[model samples]
Target: MKLRSLLFVPGDRPERFPKAVATGADALILDLEDSVVPERKPEARAAVRAWIEAPREDGPAVFVRVNPIDSDEVAADLEALAGLSLDGVVLPKAEGAESVAMLLDRLPGDYLVLPVASETPAAVFQLGTFAGVAGRLAGVTWGAEDLPASIGAATAREDDGSYTDPYRVVRALTLFGAHAAGVPAIETVFPDFRNLDALAAYAARGQRDGFTGMLAIHPTQVSVINDAFTPSEAEIAHAKAVIAAFDANPGAGALQLDGKMIDAPHLKSARRLLALVG
Candidate 1:
């Protein structure tokens, strides 16, 4: 469960399933939603179930993205996966906490849930309520394509290829909502797998903004995303130093460390970083 990166693999590509586990990602998402078309839904669902049933050399947490509850395909998907040993279901276009609760009613109690809030305008506003759902709510992510369309925007991306301002707003909202709900705020993927540098930069930015991790479209991007999210040697050292300084001077409310003022808040941040590294 020490997830730093969750890599997605097309459900129909059973050949690539083992390769995905070998990527050293924290989790693998066998996608049955966007990646699988109408014609291939049945095959994709079977392929994911088969992969889950088989023995595996790698033990990365296994997840599957089922079609949304509102979709016609969901009934069949749930019936097919009613009692399998699934780590979770990635609910696309979650309407709100109520929607999540409804899905939970259908799903078994043991299965974890992660909802994508970028599907519709109503979902964007109800990001705060996802935490109230029971079970292991993994985190919240947004879909750029769905949100812009919901708002009737011409494009989710700007001319510079960055998310438009409204999408940025939703991203921030999702981040805060996840944090408030006591779950990780997972950043969405950058679809352009060809541009490693840009992907790295964007992942690094997400890390800076307090997102715990990110999703990956391609397995090749796994290393970059994991590296960006993981605490570096220097960072760990600094965090340890901050914790030590505060621990050694318990009575003092504020003190100077390395020419900078150290306080309780800074010490807490340092400890959180160390926890991540651990």
Candidate 2:
């Protein structure tokens, strides 16, 4: 499924659910974890369940961000979601493939999973293990907010909101790990929703670095995320040209395109870009 933008909605606030769905996001994550206070967990869970069970026509695919696997509430979270139709679950703070396995074990049948694979320090080392669970994963995403707090860092971002070296490494690992896992590497939320320009730049950077999608904390970011990820007409045209060049010169291993050498790798990328648009 195309998840160029996955917008987050606080699970306790069912009044905002319809508004979130109407934001034109490709998917909506009803967050039952971080957004809910401990005292309101039960109420949030009930609200999410009711929303999921409510009759509605096809719109943005809905996913729930359950609490961490190690949390005491996880079992009840899984139990509450039993048999409810959902697009997927955003598994947070996943330490390893074992975490995914444990979640699958409790769930009744096959369900798409999008794991936040880099939230804790230990989770950084376990990123590679995601490849083993690719069959069940819709995509793999990473977060900068939790990791800094987990490691007791004062801040994960610089004054300009760019990640520092340490967090940069984590982001790269998440990207490469998702590639290794044969799934989309969704970029984490930009956090500063008010600065549309910064958000656009951040999303553009993610796209340039091979991220297929991005997470959004607010609805205002959905359009920016989607626009950034979507291939422009110029890009599509160039990709088509590259493919045509290779096809026209089948016997040649390399060809010239726009005054640059187009090789097998370029051809592969062109095909992949076209496939994404399709």
TM-score for all models, in order of appearance:
0.96, 0.98
Error of 2 at 257 (Å): 1.5
Candidate 1 clashes between residue pairs 3 or more apart in a chain or in different chains: none
On lDDT, the candidate that comes out on top is: 2
Q: Candidate 2 residues 13-67, lDDT tens each?
A: 9999999988999999999899999999899999999999999989998899999
Cα lDDT of candidate 2 equals: 0.92
Candidate 1 residue spans exceeding 4 A from truth: none
Score residue 179 of candidate 1 by CA lDDT: 83
The per-residue C-alpha lDDT of model 2 at residue 4 equals: 92
